[model samples]
Structure formats: C-alpha cells, structure tokens
Target: MEKTYLTTDELAKKIKYDCRTIRERLKDSVLIEGVHYFRPFGGRKILYIWEVIEQDMRVSGHGFGIPMANGEVCHG
Candidate 1:
C-alpha cells in the first residue's frame, strides 16, 4: 500500500497543530523518526508518515495522566 507523506506545514494543517509546536514539542517525543517521519535521500527535508501518525493519535495514552505539550505525561 502507498503511504501518505506530509511536510511540516501540511502536517500542521492536517493535525491542527502549529508547525513550531510539532517541531519543538512533538517531533522527537511523540512522532518518532523512521516510524513517524524521515529525511528523504539523507537530506534535511523531513516527511511525516500520515497513516502511522493518525493511527498512533487515535490509540495513544491509556493510563491516567495529563498529556503535556512536550509529549510527556504530567502526573500532577
């Protein structure tokens, strides 16, 4: 199956998140490299895998804790 790859801006639009937030808060924390995103041709351009991201978003965080902006759960 073909995968939907998205740039940072496109991902931001689709996910209703700011590009800066995705870059600073969610990039490495929630959206993991290789699994959720990647740099094509070993270059600086990063493309996010939409399917994986959407899937994870739908099934994230079963335990009790407030989801923080940085992707870490706050116990308090």
Candidate 2:
C-alpha cells in the first residue's frame, strides 16, 4: 500500500499548526517515531505519515481533559 507521506511544513499547513511548534513541541512528545513520522533511509529528513496521525488524533482525545504541555493530566 502506498502511504501518504508529508513534509513538516506540509503537515503544519494541513493541521493549522506552526512548523516550529511541530518540530520543537509535538515531534517527540505527542507525535511519535515510526508511527507518526520516519527518517527515510535513516537519514536526516523527516516524513510524517498522515493517515496514522489522523486516525490517532481522532482517538487520542487530546483536548478533552487530557494531558497538558506542563505535564499535567486533567482528570474529570
């Protein structure tokens, strides 16, 4: 199956997030390696897998009493 791979800037545009935020904040914490993105040829370029991320975003419930940037998990 051919997957939809996206560049960091392309992902930022599609998701309405700043590229810097993705690289600095979301890359390792929220977005994971292999599943969310990959380094092609094990080189320095990052390519995000859009389908996996989109599906996870729908299920993760990110803003609904979830974990916050300051390392706090909101419990209802």
lDDT of 2: 0.80
Model 1 per-residue lDDT tens digits across residues 1-76: 7899999999989977788978877778778999999999999999999988887867764322344855785656
Give candidate 2 misplaced runs (Cα > 4 Å). 63-76
RMSD to the true structure for each prediction, in A, is: 3.5, 3.1
Worst 10 residues of 1 by lDDT: 61-70
lDDT of 2 by residue, 1-76 (tens): 5689999999989888889878877787777898799999999999999988888777866632344568444645
Name the top TM-score candidate: 1
Q: How many clashes in each candidate? A: 0, 0
